[model samples]
Target: MAHANDAELYAQWLELLGWLDAEASARGLSFEKVADFPDYIYRMERPYDLPTTVMSVGVNSAGQPLMIAGVSPRHAQLKGVSLRLMGGSKHWHLHAGTRGLLEGKRPFTRERLAQLLDGAVRGQA
Candidate 1:
C-alpha cells in the first residue's frame, strides 16, 4: 500500500512539474528547483512586485509527498497561499479576489496558479 501511494504521488508530482514548467515559460516567469531539497521556486522574470513563491514537497508518514505552496516575504515567515497540491489533486482554499482563508475546496488549475503567482509577487496573497 505504501509503495502504491508513493508511486501515485510521484506521478502526480511529475504532472504538476510539467504543468509548472510550461506555465512559467508561457507566462515569461522563472521556475527553479531548489538545490538541497525537493522544493521549487517560481518567480517573476525581472523586476516585479510579487514575492517569490516556494513549492515545498514534504514526505508524509506514509512516504507520500505533499506539496504546499506559499510565499516567504522578506523578513516574514512562510504564509499559505490559495492553492495546494495534495493527494494527486490541486485545491483552492481562498476566496476569489480576496486573500481570506475559507472552508471547502475548489479545483486547482494552471490559470488559477498564475493568479496566485501574481498575487504572491504583489504581496497580496
Candidate 2:
C-alpha cells in the first residue's frame, strides 16, 4: 500500500484534531491547543478537580503520522502508545498500537475519542 504524503497526513491530522475538539465540547470539557509545529498538542480538562488529559500528533520513526493521548504530565512518556494513520483508500481509519489488541482499529469518531479521553483521565492508557 502507498503511504500518505505529507500533505495528506497533515489534512488527516487536522481532521482528527477537529473531531477531538468537537467531542470535548459536547462533553462540556475544556479543550485547548497547547503546542504546534513539530507536534500539535491539545489539553482537555473537566471542571472541578478532575484529571486533565493531553493529546498530541507526532511523526513516528517511520515518518508516519500518529496521535498520542494520556493523562497530563506523564501522558507523552507513560503511554507512548499512538494511533497511526492507515494509508490507502481508507484514509480515515487509525491503526491503534498496543491498545489496538483490545479495542481494535477504528475511525476517529466521537465515541472513540471519548473512550481515549476517559482512559487518559483515569491514567490507564
Candidate 3:
C-alpha cells in the first residue's frame, strides 16, 4: 500500500486542526495553538474547572505519525487517543492505545472531533 508523503500529511494535519478550532468556537470552548517544530500543540479550554484537553502531532513508539489528544501534554505523549492516516488515503482513523484502531477511516467531522475531545478531557484515551 502507498503511504502519504510529508506534504500530504502536513496538509491533512492543518485541516484537522482547523476543524477542531471551528468546533471549539461553536461549542463555546477556547482553543489555542502552539507551534513546536514539526508538531503543533492544541489546547481546548472548557467552562469551569474542567481539565483543558491538549493535543499534538507526534510519532508513536513505532514511529508512526499521529495526532494525539489527552488531558495533559505528558498524557498526550504517553497514552492519548490518536488519529492516524490510513495508507495513502486522505482519511484519518481513530486509534485507542494498544487496542489499535477503533473506527473506520473517514474524513474529519464534528462528531469525530467531539469524540476526540471527550476522550481527551476525560483521559479515557
Candidate 4:
C-alpha cells in the first residue's frame, strides 16, 4: 500500500456503505431505483426525509481519489490505478456496488471494507 491513506480511505468507504445498507434493510427501507447516472448507487431517504441521499463508494486511484465502480472508458484518467468515487469524477463501479448494497444492507464502513478486501484476496467474503 504505497498510498496507505488513500487505500485505507477507499476500504473504509466500502465498509460504511455496507453498514448503511444493512441498517436500511432492518428498517424495511428499500431503494430499488438507481440514480439518473449510470454509476453504482441508489438514492435513499426515510419516509419523511427532506431529501434523498446520494451515496457513492469505491476503490481510490493513485494520485487521483476517484473510485471506479463498474466500468468506464475514462478509467485511464486514473492511469490504471484502483480508486473509488471520492473526487469529482463519478466512478460508476462504486455507485453500482453501493446502489446494490443500499437495496440489500446499509452504507459501507471501514471495518466492512477490510473484510471485503480480505475476501476478495482469498476469493471469498
Among all windows of 10 consecutive residues in model 2, the one with the lowest summed lDDT is: 71-80
Which pairs clash (backbone N, Cα, C closer than 3 Å) in model 2?
none
Q: Clash number for every model?
A: 4, 0, 0, 33
Off by over 4 Å in 1: 1-4, 36-105
Off by over 4 Å in 4: 1-4, 31-125
- Give the higher-lDDT candidate: 1 or 3: 3
Query: What's the distance in Å from true for residue 57, model 3?
Result: 8.3
Error of 1 at 56 (Å): 5.8
TM-score of each: 0.39, 0.41, 0.40, 0.27
Q: State model 3's lDDT.
A: 0.40
For candidate 4, the TM-score is: 0.27
lDDT of 4 at 47: 40
Quote the RMSD, in angstroms, for model 4: 15.3
lDDT of 2 by residue, 31-50 (tens): 55444332223333523221
Runs with alpha carbons beyond 4 Å of true place in candidate 3: 38-110, 118-125
Selected candidate, larger TM-score, 3 vs 4:
3
Candidate 1 lDDT tens digits, 87-116? 545455432212222233443456665675
Highest-scoring model, lDDT: 3
lDDT of 3 by residue, 39-112 (tens): 22333352322222224543222343223432222323322234533233333444332222234443445576
Task: Report how far off residue 117 is in candidate 4 (Å).
Answer: 26
